[model samples]
Target: MKNDKADFIPIFDGHSLAGWHPVPRLPVSRAPGEPSPDPDDERYRRAMQTTGKWTVEHGAITGRQDPPGCGYGGYLLSDGVYGDFELLFEARPDWPADTGILVRASSLGSQGFQILLDHRRSGNIGGIYGNGIGGFHGINFTLDAKYDEHGRPIGLRLEDPAAAIEPMTPDKPALLDDAATGEQFLSRWKWDDWNEFRIRVEGASPRITVHINDGKISEIDTEALKHPLYNAAAVRDLLGPKGHIAFEIHDNDPGMGEARWGANAACRWRNIRIREL
Candidate 1:
């Protein structure tokens, strides 16, 4: 049966990070036109020192971006790579927090789609993001739109380019139980409680599906990825067929900056499991 329990396997033991590792830091550029810093930069070392903050507590893996100890946040990458699979998990986020799970990620930078766990008025839960590749600015809420072979968004473009910094807006939520629109889904997301999340990915063209709290949210097929949708050329070359799974701790704002999340803006995950399809 589709609802059978044995189809899935636990990836997080609820007590230890036995199969996960902190992602290596990528080179950062201090300013435009300046050469990017080496991977061995001091910032990378400082970031690694903070991995201890990602702790397994009360049967949940919790990440806290506390400054002075760890502020430049990064991803907690899985030691293994995955292709076609369904991942089931739950997350509780502090208001004004930004986090996501990266699928098919490469070590250099997150290379696949990031299911957005953004929890702020300007953010969208269950949004699809092309991490290191594609033109979507990582907050694509419209799902039915199709792209051309060149990656240009052709059929329907739902959102304007995301603002450099998401503006503070009043919290007026809409029902998401049977959400008819992305805005509804965003509104229905539980901000103060744990919410269920799921993702499924498959095929060479890479079709992705996202669900939040058991409500169907977003879906995308990347076969039509084209220019304007992201740098199609760079995506084709950098994005691989399969890679690791990782969780993000977005450092800066616009999404969920350290300032917004505060010194201890926390994001918690539990019941993390995946099943190959």
Candidate 2:
């Protein structure tokens, strides 16, 4: 069920990022965005001049890789921590944008439970992922480009998920309880328009249910999970009972022949509301 707007709290002000901060979500021991000291270091050249930040544009929270095609990625996390709640938002991404929502995210940017919105080639949107808690994926089919004669993406076609998944998420998530077919999702999602998402996350051992345009799409229950690498106890210890809500600006791994996020393309969000349960 949707939360009552009268009782809901606004997560975004619609004018500014008051309680949110951008963090470089890197998979490394070193601090994210810490430029290499030596000029000779290869990582030094990759240091972003002005990438990995979110901004308000035309009354929406917009996220993108800055300077057109720079190699950078990060998360925009809320300041407060929430235990269980229903989150409401609308997303309208460019033809090729790699973005997602995070619940129970760590402020340090390491761990989180993600609702996948990989809107590029060979990607899937209505899936779930264990970010740093455990590297797992939960999606049956991926999406491929369906372009018009103008060489612009018009819609998405379903494909085998094997080629698109990230390297980290090789196994199924600790618990992938329920999901809709890829064909069903494509039929429901409105292309080049805002799609409302209502997410309900509840229980100490959370059961996250995602609804797009008020239609149920997927569910994940981490309770009684038996996956080898996914330890529920360890994850809870790291993130605690309460954690921040975050958003992802996924990397454009140029070296690996991946253009997941289009150059300077943005994912737009609006009407972010939360109702703590």
Candidate 3:
């Protein structure tokens, strides 16, 4: 039942590079004695400086946000563009942090999908962010049965049927087909701690599966729909074969009430592998 076909391949298994090319970290405009930036930092600032990129430590890539107006506060990236591939990584937020994985990005802006990582009740985990209607791509089709001592679902939340019915694109709309519902079931079974995330893309559609503590949590089929944005066709044409992959370290203003940001966020990753299927 698992779709194994993908265009991109994995390069690492834990700390070892499985066989794929490892993206190099570019320098940014951070002050001296600051930490090194992640490989994805080259895209945001237009040019590489040493400010917001993170270094690989203790297994995961960490991200930091620059001050406001310093060219889009978070780390920018422009390396390792992929299409029709599978990506796997593990993210752990710092108590209350916000971050995401951006796919199909371009210099103009992010025109693809985002896999968000926020621990808020209102926001759905393993969902898409900032493509007009927020979190539309993140279809919460399932729920986990386990609950904490406080009776809350252990690392999982029930689907908001109202949100699921919202339209993704005006023309394309959103479809909660049987496959999507199945995906929700799996996602609800995930664990709370650091877990593995599997994202598979084929042509215009992508599938996501999460493994919490080495157990399958959820898997969603995203092949029937077109891209989330209206301009996706043109952007895809411009990208040609490969698309860019990036990590978002969003910023927040103290005055902005309860808006989420990537404050105190960090993660570790190993065994990153991809294959062109």
Best by lDDT: 2
* Clash number for candidate 1: 10
Greater-lDDT candidate between 1 and 3: 1
Q: Per-residue lDDT for 4-40 in model 1, tens only?
A: 4467899999999899887543433322233555657
RMSD of 1: 10.1
> TM-scores for all candidates?
0.74, 0.86, 0.57
- Which lDDT value does model 2 have at 55? 91
**After best superposition, candidate 1 residue 119: deviation in angstroms?**
1.3
Model 3 lDDT tens row, 1-277: 2554244455543343222222222332232122444656535343334344455566656555443223323443444567766676666654234456666554322334566665443334555443321224544432223356996545555545454323233222233232234344354434545666676556654554544434443344444434333233443454454666666554443433223443434434444556644
What C-alpha lDDT, on a 0 to 100 scale, does residue 203 get in candidate 1? Answer: 73
Rank ordering of all candidates by TM-score, starting from the highest: 2, 1, 3
Distance from true location, Cα of 29 in model 3, Å: 25
Off by over 4 Å in 2: 1-3, 28-51, 160-174, 254-258
Candidate closest to the true structure, highest TM-score: 2
| Model 2 Cα lDDT, one tens digit per residue, 206-269 | 8898888777788888766556566777777767888899888877675533367777688999
Which window of 10 residues has the lowest lDDT sum in candidate 3? 17-26
CA lDDT scores, all candidates in order: 0.63, 0.76, 0.45
TM-score of decoy 1: 0.74
Backbone clash pairs for candidate 2 read none
